[model samples]
Target: MTTSKRPQNRADWQALAETLIPSLETRAFIDDAFVDAASGETLETLNPASGETLAHVASCDAADAELAVAAARAAHARGDWARLAPAKRKRVLLRLAELMEAHKDELALLDTLDMGKPVSSSLGDMAGAIGSIRHQAESIDKVYGEVAPTGDDSLGLVLREPLGVVASIVPWNFPLMMTAWKIAPALAAGNCVILKPSEKSPLSALRLAGLAKEAGLPRGVFQVLPGYGHTAGKALALSMEVDCLSFTGSTQVGKQLMQYAGQSNLKRVYLECGGKSPNIVFADCKNLDKVAKRAAAAIFHNQGEVCIAGSRLLVENSIREAFVDKVVEAAKAMQPGNPLDPESFMGAMVDETQYRRVLDYIAKGREEGAQLRAGGASLEGPGYFIPPTVFDGVTPAMTIGREEIFGPVLSVFGFDSEEEAVAMANDSDYGLAAGLWSQDIDRIMRVSRRLHSGQVFVNNWAGGDQTVPFGGVKQSGNGRDKSHHSLAEYTELKTVWMSLQG
Candidate 1:
């Protein structure tokens, strides 16, 4: 008897390598069915890894946002989308998931070219995007309204309905995945959505609109407007026609969005903003080297572009030096290179502006009397890349410690006691996510409970399961993504009270 052999892990990736194309360009999907932008301008997308021009994205202005919003409102009012049954909508979402999976390689390449994340990581992001859509699709029909107990003569019912005309603004970092996170749930909830992808990385979002169309979604139900944040993003925030706004970006921009919502109309605003999250390493941590390695990866992943990066390293004073040494070694091992290369770990920053911003922050750290352990300047190339940097003696007051650099820069600080560590962790205005590395269950429970963050990791850095809610506290913005809580955000409740007349 003979049996077929299963492919090894190396062979699996090699199979995917056959599908990878070096030059794949997905043109921006404009809603030709709707009116064009009044400005009649275009924005050029650049490959941050090589500084080469990629594609020309539509430069949508206020008028363009208005057109998109009007189309969404019309789609909702006409019941072209919002009237669909939850199960039918779920089917459409499932089709979308299938389409995304079919074109995973193309989408991954587009993401790498536009945003400068490693191809390996970009592929993972594409997979996660598909998973998010599929997860939301499966859960859409499971959402049910409550039926209140009432007298025999009458019935009391509660209805959960979609918030129509949703405006989704996604950040450049994790562009494809974040867009799917917002649009999938919004559409599954029966809302017509207008998506605004960040100008820096708009390719995947545009391609997603095309995929949604292919999935049997009606026109005007899903639209993509790629432009500057000030114009397109602000328009969505302030538009009275838009029912609610979902945004993911910086804390400063989140505040501006809140102001816009208040100034124009009191639209519900949901944001996932910046984080200066702490990665605490206690003396009793099992596998100290492994913890340190993960800690380095958490901060340096995507060139530290993630909103939940463990940028602030808080270690017990007893083991601070050793942990720092390990972390520095791990950081040194990651070499920045072309995002399309499978071997590269670190990639370029989003653009010149972000590159300069990270450099300036590093300079500020040095001026504030912090010791620069490694890498402090930009790489010499056509692309916008920064080396992995680490700063020692980082006080809470220093700019590098407080601000979101959004680059491959780690700031290390030491604390003597558990109380001090917790205090230092909670010192930041942003409370997105925090991590604790320790073997003691008591320490994990205590520190996890004390930390002022939305998500906490025990003996790990970044691990997101579909079942758990992900978001932030305080200035990190309100509302949750993933889990059942995200489903609640897309819906509105209506209660019907009945009185029995005997």
Candidate 2:
């Protein structure tokens, strides 16, 4: 397959470059400045496109995490940031968003190199990240408390206050976007944040801290600590100084964070975790080819590293074979290539560990009697690359169908009745998100209401607007991330009831 072509000159660069940067800095952002980790340890950032070392990032440890947490705690206690009026806080957030837009190219490049997502997608992510900040900034003052009607001579009211010192652990798949999802709301709500980006893709988070500084955000209000999960992530979760813990990652780690929250200070824990989401396709009224292509893109996008990926495909028996054929054809058309290329649809996996885990799942699927339809093996290269894989004749009990493969692997299963399809989809422990494809309005309404998932997509897959709440049910984890409701997660409500005087 041919790789996507690159831009020739400055004019062509406009299509790809979201921001213009003077230069890319290789450093960590902490305590209001760009600095290296205290330990002086460093890890090499690799370009998955070419399996080359892009740069070296600070290898932070527990000490670094502690420093960041301390900084956040100090900021909160001093009230240098939290004492600001909502409008002033909004101004700071708006400035941060502007800075993010200005630095979009650097952020996108870092994301492409660190996580191996296509540059086009990375640019989109940068834009989304900026929008998230702006959304929360515009929303800060509008979020008001309730005023209850009281008896004569008595006034009753409720007020909302910031939950101080939030430790936000963001995942690698959409590093900057997830960071903004966690940070923008917390900061807008007047809380200090200590962000922990996944070690695999920490560069952008570090760069964002620099941008935050450039935007004139107060010292210690926001700090970025890059380190392994066991050390830095654990410290954040278990820190008594932290008032709330927000995380986006796997189900296993979410459970651990909950435990830490319970043991530490019983602080509020918000998690957006794993998903084995179902994409149900019924023999509908129109456009099977379009549905097939969309299905392929839904699963194959970001190499299927998304938590809401429509991995388990349940199709009606009548059109199963034809749908599978169309999906396989679409998969064959995808070419994993250099992420720097604007046209590349697929790129390498984040790291070797994830690559091996995906390969194991593929092997397990074959051993368990699922027929490999297309693209099962790993790609030949130094970078961790896997082909877009599809498996047919898959049973609900198969490992590939049950587990979150989290790779470019799509499993196809057929069902006869509507009840059977719903049953198959809801069988998993995860209830994050599910996709239903049918032109039948009744079917869409019925299936959407019946599904035990958080966000249900009818005739589409994983398209979220800022106004809508995004989260999951059961093991997929709890607490909404993106809407006006998200502001509630970062706040504490207090009721003031007064007694009437004689």
Candidate 3:
């Protein structure tokens, strides 16, 4: 209710964001209050768009992580949150979702300034985050225990119970949204949560902790720790008190978390990691122009910081050059721009390290004999900006075609047969998601089944709702993020059997 005024335009949003930067909350939220790290260490969170320092957030280490875990453990044991009635817990989460909507603009701006996403796009992330909370809350009371059929004089009961304490480690690409994806279900399952947001974009998660308290969550039930992965992240993963650890990051880091779990309490770990998803275009596709535009957007959107981006484009040989040309034309329209401008279709890289890493991949692409048909260089400015890049004559053997660049770079390949296309698409360490364009229903069904991916989009790209499950296969990591299935990840199943002989 305190947020009575709304920004009317991009200029208003930009101005409001400027006013907010100086006063941004940079402390970690531990045991329901803002506090400094135990080591008194801090890390400067930079505005990737302007290349300016935003604030020095608390750099939580093992000590701070220990404090947060202790608080969460005590809260879970007290049952103030875990033992609350299902309907009451649902009400609290609904209230939290309402508060999120009320503070949507501020939350969106925090992420935009921290990670250099366009404010317009961050607003959409806010919508997704709010919807995620609402959806999980509504399902809390509806999830019911089951009774197993038993013989006479015997009874069996099946129950699902929350894990005691959960630690959510999320990536920066979709900061708030990824946090919501993990915490919503964990909280809905009646578990205390400790969030360790990526250091590159920790602002939004810190802001959400305040709104969570305002929405009537119990003290110590939810907390946020902003720090490096080696310290805070590793501490949580290796903690004996933490019951479950859910992470969305790289495959390399995901492996480390699993190792940490094995070295500690052997707690459950859920991971959603990297991807090299392929978007295939058949010669018999629908409208080439429409597919071309979609293909372009699938890679170039979000400055290509998406985990499931269709970075590899596989086209039939007969139409490969023409389709690549159309895609190049489309990419030209999506050049990087100032993220604060609502009209800007694309934004800067999340930070300097990722910016340089992407440029290195582009260089590799050129050196590996892939043709640079479109933008390949960073825009000259203070911030990290890279335009949409497309490479032609890409082969599976090339470095760019094989790696997950995590930038606005596309590698195009040509295949002569349908079998070759399927083989080429399936030939990768990742099996996250794939996109295909074809009119023949039989071919669609056959190829979709053959492709080794968790989700497949036919005749389009990037199509999915929260109602359906989201995650990946193979090295892409285990566990699902969205839909009813995700709720299962936060809970443990127990079956009780009893017999009466009296």
Candidate 4:
């Protein structure tokens, strides 16, 4: 129990961290038992905030991935999961969600320590994760397949069957919440799942598997393998036996997985990848203050690690300076500090790699002749901390404006007309999400329809309930997460034609 450099407020989380951090089992949870990586390799998980060792987790490779897939297949064949009634599965997941909520504080702490997200923000992420799991569980039995009308002589049926073995590869950012987004629906749809958590943030996902088991989820129906994408994740994608794979991460990695799917048994692959989202504001927006505040939160929240971060500020030329000033004012207030501190709005970058990458992007922005408005330098601390940065006079051709930095960096570009705004927003190779702030219904309607993004937030900057379908268009990747659409992704559509066809 190393609490020497850690920040502790509100005795509960501190106590829980003390209790869990020392006793962490770094081994992968496979077939209901903790085991070492098949390669006998280990990865040391660190507290991104304090640069302290949390645990040395097992790094599962292809061989271990094979073992997990075999277990999942056998379990599905034995009807350990797939044969459960929809209602029964729903109950099991409901209990799982309840257990997760009960230990929300502990889970939130683990999330914060593992990935340098603010303690407060991690707590909110846990709440959302619970809601996502519960929503899917509650809706499992309520959703019904359609029955088509047929001739008097025969009947036609359309049904959705579980896709046997499902594999989920989640990102380091919002690890637990992304896990909930993928696996909850997969479970409710009566499919066995193999969760491959990012090696950088595997603690909460490992704990979640234990919670699922505690809620009476059958053995082999759920398993967690902590490893890198190239080894374990590739194995899942390369497996002919794996029915489907759901992934969340970078677009480059997403494209690689898609190619792996083609080279393998052609398993179904759904990806929610990178974004350089445009947060456009028209002069007609009713609340510039609200826009400035939320827009700052949008780019600086989670250290700007979000896939749908509003990184590009596309403002109308008429009010560009005023809005930029307000945004700069807001960003200057979000200081990166100790993740465990309750008052800290921003936290460290997830690790040194991310920290270096953000610094590199900041340098690039300066080299490309963009105006540096707010904080841009790394903070003096033990942790990997970088202050929120704003760049004005950014051209679409610049690297900062075009690339996904995945850090607290904002690039502002001005447009004179609606056509120019839409053009600049759509010019990027990525289009996961876009945000627009305008009160005019006609303008909102027109721009919302014209944008190529998967989601266009009207008044809000970044937000989505579990009921909404999420995923991106173009290079942002294919398919959808959340909502019944996500639940449906884990099932195979089968149409039964009767004698009427003959």
Candidate 5:
């Protein structure tokens, strides 16, 4: 209805922000119908940018989740999605991707409003999500099953089949992209999916279900349940009929979901959880300037709600002060701006609770005696905005250095050697991801191998694609999200042994 509101320039974006009263669609899609849950309740989804109500989403409950699961089961039993040929499934997903591309700007704007991320960054997220969908769609028919070597009288076949009724609980940080990461492969493998997006940001997921339906995905094949995790997410997890649960959120929540799975049907649970990823800056042969800039970006991107945010910065003692100064300068440039502004590199925190939590961490840093070198205050704005804060002299024991702050706050530590840096980085409850800025190939190889992290970025932080496997280790949770490896999570491998003598 408001195609003209699609911003083409900074001025246009700014104008749209000022005058836009976007009437966002918010409803639970079950059995291909847009309506409320059984209880007939609604919840207000607010714009994180201006703290205004964006949409009133359907507040789905356990009963609604049950209805959705029943629909999915019916669809699966009827051979609507789970029995489709891989190529046909790919076509449906590809069409969905095309539609997503056609309305990318609309989706991007919805995400920006819903989660307080910069509109420019939301566009990137839309691109990533769409790319993920298309790639998984194209890959559906390409990957082949395996043949096993067996005894002389026996033939063995290893076949991969879709695990029916995959339910996902995606986080709010990168809602659309994370949704794509979880559902695309599952759908491509020919499974019905139930997505319960984070209550903090559910608009995009609700909108996405419509796009999927319009793209010709069968009823009940893909459903979006918009509600709190404790309600819909718990209900989906506790269902004995649901086959698998893939989640991306806090480590604590992930562990709880795993318990819920065990308490119910023992559905396979795949979790990609929290991270306090370390960004190690060795006294390399070159490029402190570039690394400093990247370091700043790594922690501050998405207002630091990123699961693999390089929150802990380990700087070689030699370049500590100078590198930190460069980082501080970089942070200064990333000042929080209106989310609708195309030029706003850093926007508000996702919501008020997270905003308060971040501020609490900053206080903890000061109370623990870590030197607050840069920003240590929240920005004066309507929405939740925190200045990019840096804390130097942050020891491993300090709260700032150990915890996943989930804010645009950096904890700086000095490392004497590569081994020490590796030790400090690994000395955490999490082993999700780590990043290093060094030119020595041997050091790079050795440190990367030695670090206890799922993903190691050689010269960058949190950089990769759908082609690469992305996941974490330790308390950061298990299972990969992207690549061919992710496809395995949604499928169960059955070994078929046939006797030739029979």
Candidate 6:
């Protein structure tokens, strides 16, 4: 795979996309080649931006999953990857990263067409994915095993070894980025990986398979199975041959995977699941205007499909009305537009089902008596698009305030004091992420420490680099991703002690 000339602007991108859409790879990649499902069945992948069928992708099921698992098992046993030298593995992964960077434009375009996210956003996401791979590759040789403390007559060693087979099931919201987050570390640790991408956005993963092959990954070392969650996803989770299952999606599905793991081989399951994160704004915060802009982007970005989106906004009562007004204006400016257009800030929902689900939540907000402040109706068009919707005067008991809508909807609540704000933010089943804006260092530290979230941002919203660990507690699921911490999940720690008696 090599770099191709990319389009410069919206019109150019639209023209280029027309030529690329017709030739996308739509079959599963198994054992380093694209193959049809064993059942010979295919599923139609729709473009949410235009409500049109992009391609008929091979619909893999349990049988295909079995094939993938067998390949992974064989690859692990063959020792071509799992037993390879760390330096050699690092070189292969570095080459893969280079290939991904070379063909980033094509990968980004496929994600945009398949999932209805803005092309600009996909491009940025591709950069993150590529960088993650590079980071993992570079860290391969740097990870050191430990020599445990022991008496002179005894020797103790702690070793980190790769889990045999890793099945990565990623969500459509950030397909490439999330997939990279899982597979890069697993592969960097010299493990065989089988990726089951969301049926809604499988193109990027399918495209990525060929690059893996081009970068010298052994046959059967990496594969992509594209199918429904109940079929392909369940098969991977329940397979006895799989040694680890890493997933990012809804909490409900995460629980199912856990059950499957228990029923099967008790594979190591690492999940980063759903969230109804809160963004608390204190009265002592300086720069209300900056806070309002960040608040809008935190919830409204990616069309509010983000699992860590700041959907619940907690504001101090003294600035609740004024802050919401500014947020509303910012939301108004982020109207839905053609995903191919670089200028578009927001795009259509992933599909009609999610589109209607968000709409149903909006209707429930109205029925539950939350005050509607901004856009509420769905946009009249062929695509599944809903403009940013804001609901003020929301109580903690309201449906919109408590649930994860997973759309561009904001529920606002007012609190009288810092204690009340912290309480409101912690009042959720999810503890994935939270945000608070305050100038006072004492308040920022106090509130940040008390929030029941895995990651907290003060004076910003979801602003963290790849070096930071990302995960959640409670229902948001277990295990972490990113940085050296994520690498631990893909590996197992073993201690060996030897006695030296002469």
- TM-scores, in order shown? 0.94, 0.94, 0.98, 0.97, 0.97, 0.99
Once fitted onto the true fold, the runs of candidate 2 whose alpha carbons sit more than 4 angstroms away are 1-26, 500-502
Ordered by TM-score, highest first, the candidates read 6, 3, 5, 4, 2, 1
Candidate 3, 1-502: lDDT as tens digits? 2346887677887888878887788999999999999999999989888889999999999999999999999999899999999999999999999999988989988888899988888889999999999999999998888989888898899999999899999999999999999999999999999999999999999989999999999988999999999999999999999999999999999999999999999999999999999999999997898899999999988999999999999999999888988999998889888888877788989999999999999999999899999988889879999999999999999999999999999999999998999999999999999999999899999999999998899987878777888999999998999888999899999999999666
Clashing pairs in 1: none
Once model 1 is optimally superposed onto the true structure by TM-score, how far is the C-alpha of residue 162 displaced, in angstroms?
0.6
Please, what are the lDDT tens digits per residue for candidate 6 over residues 1-502?
A: 3336677788877777787778788899998889999999999999998889999999999999999999999999999998999999999999999999889888888899999999999999999999899988988999999998889999999999998999999999999999999999999998999999999999999999989999999989999999999999999999999999999999999999999999999999999999999999988888898889889999999999999999999999998989999999998789889998888999999999999999999999999999999889999969999999999999999989999999999999999999889888998999999999988998888988999999998888888777898999989989898898998788899999999987
| lDDT on C-alpha atoms for all candidate structures | 0.85, 0.86, 0.93, 0.91, 0.89, 0.93
Q: What tens digits encode model 1's per-residue C-alpha lDDT throughout 1-502?
A: 0113322343443344344323322333444353345777888888887777877767888888888888788888888778888788889999999988877866876788788888888888988889889988999889889998876888799998889989889999999988888887888888988889999988777767777888999868998888889998888898998889999999998999989999987989999999999999899988878888899999999999999999999999999998899999888888687676677898889888898999999999999999998889888968998988999899999999999989999999999999999999999999999999888888889999999999999887878766778899999989788777798899999998776774
Count of clashing residue pairs in every prediction? 0, 0, 0, 0, 0, 0
Per-residue lDDT tens digits for candidate 4, residues 329-438, read 99877988777778889998999999999999999999999999998899886989999999999999899999999999999999999999999999999989999999
lDDT, candidate 5, equals 0.89
Clashing pairs in 3: none
Q: Please give the lDDT score for candidate 1.
A: 0.85
Looking at model 4, which ten-residue stretch has the lowest summed lDDT?
A: 1-10
Q: Where does candidate 2 clash, by residue pair? A: none
